[model samples]
Each structure stands twice: as structure tokens, then as C-alpha cells.
Target chain A: MPLEAPVEVMLAASAGNVLVWVVWVVAALALLSSGIAVVLFTNPFYSALSLIGNLASLAVLYLLLSGEFVAGAQVIVYAGAIVIMFVFVLAYLGGRADAPWAGGPTLQAAAAVVAAAAIALEVIVVIALAAGDQLSDTAEVTGAFGSPAEIGDLFLSDHLLAFEATSIVLLVAAVGGVILGSAMPQRSKAGAD
Target chain B: MLGPGIAAYLILSVVLFATGAFGVLIRRSPLIILLALELMLNAGNLALIAFSRQLGNGDGQIFALTVMVVAAAEAVLGLGLIVAVSRKRVELDVDKLTTLSG
Candidate 1:
């Protein structure tokens, strides 16, 4: 509505929108670094670290996309909890260098290249679509969702089922991992004896 | 041209997703693969949120929230498996994990 008012008003609005674009650029750079990390690092530890950075960057990007609740959750769950779990497991497994890097034959490399090409093509399509006037919607992102009270309402009311499900899933996974990990030592000891 | 449109975000997400996919195909370490999987999932989440904002809907953000939880769960379970397997085998070579293949 405001953009349709007048030339001067539209110019003013566009000027104000520059702040959001600047943020977008910064977030994009962060995401880019994370992507490069994923490709270059063979070590799982380094990969995990890069993934953490990537997750944190994605969380900020989520904020820019107007998903404040998701953004905070991304940081807390992904960067905080899951990354810790990954690092712990990696340490227990004697780090990434000891793990196998080339598990398959030479064909896998070709496959990887093909897959990368396909992904690049998909991105090109998305870029073309975005350039056209196909998408017409509100760009306003709510800042209030990041507040405690509003977030609580959204968590309890709008997403109660999913929330409960996540807790249950995490509980199951924790117990299962422990059982599996603990059993290995005893099994190996029996074989040695 | 890339000021504030949905395409800029989409293109970026695609690159991120491609990198993750390439990592998945190239890397043999399950832990690294799992991390790559997380990257791919996050790329999808970015796309979803961007589209949701472009369409003025709350559902995309909601789905992205769910995906994050699932990704966490996946990482926990996945790493646990990696640790358990490594106790005896000592190394998790993708080629060596052929128990499933006939």
C-alpha cells in the first residue's frame, strides 16, 4: 500500500529497505563460507565445526525471513545441543582422519560431480523464477514473535503437537544411543577374552 | 537486480544445498556425511522460509521449525550409531559398511 502512494514516498520506502538488504548480504556471505567448509573439509571434526557455523548463519537467515521462533530454535537446538552431540561422538570415534574417506570406487566421484551439476541447475531455475513477477506477497516480517510472550503463545498454541513429538523423539534417541554405545565395549571384550 | 527479491535467497540456498549434496556424495565418513545432511536440510529450510515470506504464510516457518527439531534428532541418533560402530571397527569406511548390501 505504501509503495503505491507516490514516487517520492516509494523512493523513501526503498531507501529504508536498504537496511534489510544489507543484512541479507551479510547472511549470504556467512552461508557461503559454511558451504565451502562442507566441500573442502574431509575431517568430520572440521566438518562439524563448519556445520555449526552454517547452522548459526542459517538461524540468522531465518530471522531475516521473518521466522523468529524458528531462528531461535535453530540456534538453541542445532548449534547448542546437536553440535555438541556430534563433537562428542566424533571424539569417541577417534576423530575424522581415522574414518574412511574413499569408501567407494572411482564411479562415486563422477556421481558427485553429476549431483553437483543437477543442484546448480536447480538453483538457476529458482533464480529465474524469482526474477519474474510470479511472486506477489507481503514482505513484512514480524519482530514481535521474537519476544517472550508472543513466542510462548506460538509454541504452546500453534505448535503444541510438534513440540511434544520432538521431546519424545529426543528422549528415545538418547536412550537408544546410550544402549548401543555401551553395548559395544562389552561385546568387544567378550571377543577378546 | 538482486536487492530484495525471493530469487536472491533462493539462489543462495541452492548453492548451499549443492555443496551439502556434493559433500554427501564425496565423503565416506558417516559423521561428515551426517553434517552434510544437516546442511542440506538447513538449505531446504531457508528456501521454505523465504518462500513463505514471499507468500505471506505462517506454515513455511512452522515447517522449518519442525525440520530443525528433526535434524537435531537425526544428528543425535546418527552420531550415536557412528560411535557404537567405531568401537569395534575403529574406522567407519563407507565401503566397509556393506552389511546391508547383498
Candidate 2:
């Protein structure tokens, strides 16, 4: 009996791979719980830490989705640089963890919740409809899917304008930050003098 | 053979977005609001990458990268503004920022 590749092996290899499932579950849980911690933690400092956790978990999720470059950017830009900025602001603000927060107006909170629920339900329904007859297995990931080279090519070729625009935006943001930071001290000094 | 599908990823994105929305509404601190906004942006990136994977296209990932750059810039400028506001000893609560509330 000529044995072709066994069904079990094929099933174990692709989307049904147990490792993928485990990683997905872990990453999703981390993404969610850390997000909750960000919102619930009273201390803004703690919230920043939680946001870092959330960002890191999101990086992991990006990796699981086979987006290596995105995952790296998530770690570098978000978990590293952005979170550090948040911490600096927290520290600059005296790291006051005990700020009194009499949670915002109740009506606004209820409105937000309702809006969020409605949006969530709409998204779930759309996803369900979209995926109803189209639950395909994970695509065969080629070597070039999320590689830096592929992304760079895309940036240089198709997304050149947008890429250049982003650079300009970053430069502007930097200058604005400097201006905002410097102008304040002088004004405050003037007020004092 | 039930591996996570596009729907699963989409559901996660939706949940994350909703959490961000809830945070934006419930939290008064400008910093927390910025963090929540980051969460929402990340959610958008996640969805983009997921679709990129599903469609076997690189465009989504590229867009996600662009979004990350924008997010970083936004974070920097936002933190700067927050610092400027705090320097004046103005209350950080959003509700109390009624200087322009006509």
C-alpha cells in the first residue's frame, strides 16, 4: 500500500496546528487583560505600565499573524519609544499616583458604553457574515510576506508619497514639541518675573 | 480543524477597539485618553495586518507601518501638550478643561 502523506500529518501542520492555537489564546488574553489593567488602574503610572504590557502583547499577536516587521515596529515604536515618552510625562507630572478621579459624568459614560456596544455588535455581525462561508485556512506564508525588504520595496515603489509624507509629519511633530516645550518655560518665567 | 480564522482576529480587533472607546469615555486624564487612543490605533493596525495575512498582500502591512509612525508622532506631540498643560498647574481632568467651553 503506497502511503501518501497521512491525513493526521497534514492536519497537524497547517491552521489546525496546536501551537498556533495556544499562542493565539495566550496573546489574545494578554492583549485583553493588560488593556483592562490600563483602564482600571487608578495610578496613571500603573496605567502606563499596563499600556506597555498591552503593547508588548500586541506585538506578539502581530508576530502570530506573520507580520514580522509590524511586530518589530510595535515593539520598537510602541512598547519602547512611546511607552517611555508616557513614563517621562508621568514622572514630569510628579508621578502622582493618588490623583483624585471622580470618574467622568455618568451620562457620558453610559453614552460611551452604549456606543461601544453597538459598534462591537456591528463589527461582530459583519465579521460573522464575511466569514460565514469563507473560513479559509491560513495562507501559505512565503518567505517574503512581512520581511523588511518586502516592506521597503512597497514603501519605495507604491507607497512612496505616503512614506515621504510621514517623514515630514514626524519632523513637524518634533519641531512642534520643541516649540511647545520651550515656549512654556519662557512664558512661565515671564509671569514669575 | 478549528484554527483561529479571520473572524477571530476581527473579533479581537473589535474588542480592543471597544475597550479603547470605553477608556476614552470613562477616563478623564489626558494621558490615559492618549493611551486609549493608542490602543485604538493598535487595534486598527492589528486588523490591517490580519487582513494582509489573509489576502497574501503586503499593502496592509505597509499601511500598518505608516499608522505606527503616525501613532508615535501623535504620542510625542500629545505628551508635549500634556506637559505644557501640567506646567501651568491646570487640572488634568478633561471635564475641568472648560477654558473654551462657551
DockQ by candidate, in order: 0.58, 0.68
lDDT of 2 by residue, A1-46 (tens): 4476676567668745678789889989999998878876889989
**Error of model 2, residue B81, in angstroms:** 0.8
lDDT per residue as tens, model 2, B1-102: 234877688789999998888888788888988998998998899889888888788999999999999998898899888888887789888889889888
TM-score for chain A in each prediction: 0.71, 0.82
Root-mean-square deviation per candidate: 4.3, 2.9
Judging by lDDT against the true structure, name the best candidate: 2
How is the predicted docking of candidate 1 categorized under the CAPRI scheme? medium
Q: Candidate 2 chain A, which ten residues in sequence have the lowest lDDT sum?
A: A96-105
Clashing pairs in 2: none
True contacts kept of each: 0.65, 0.75
TM-score for each prediction?
A: 0.82, 0.89
- Candidate 2's displacement at residue A30, Å, is 0.7
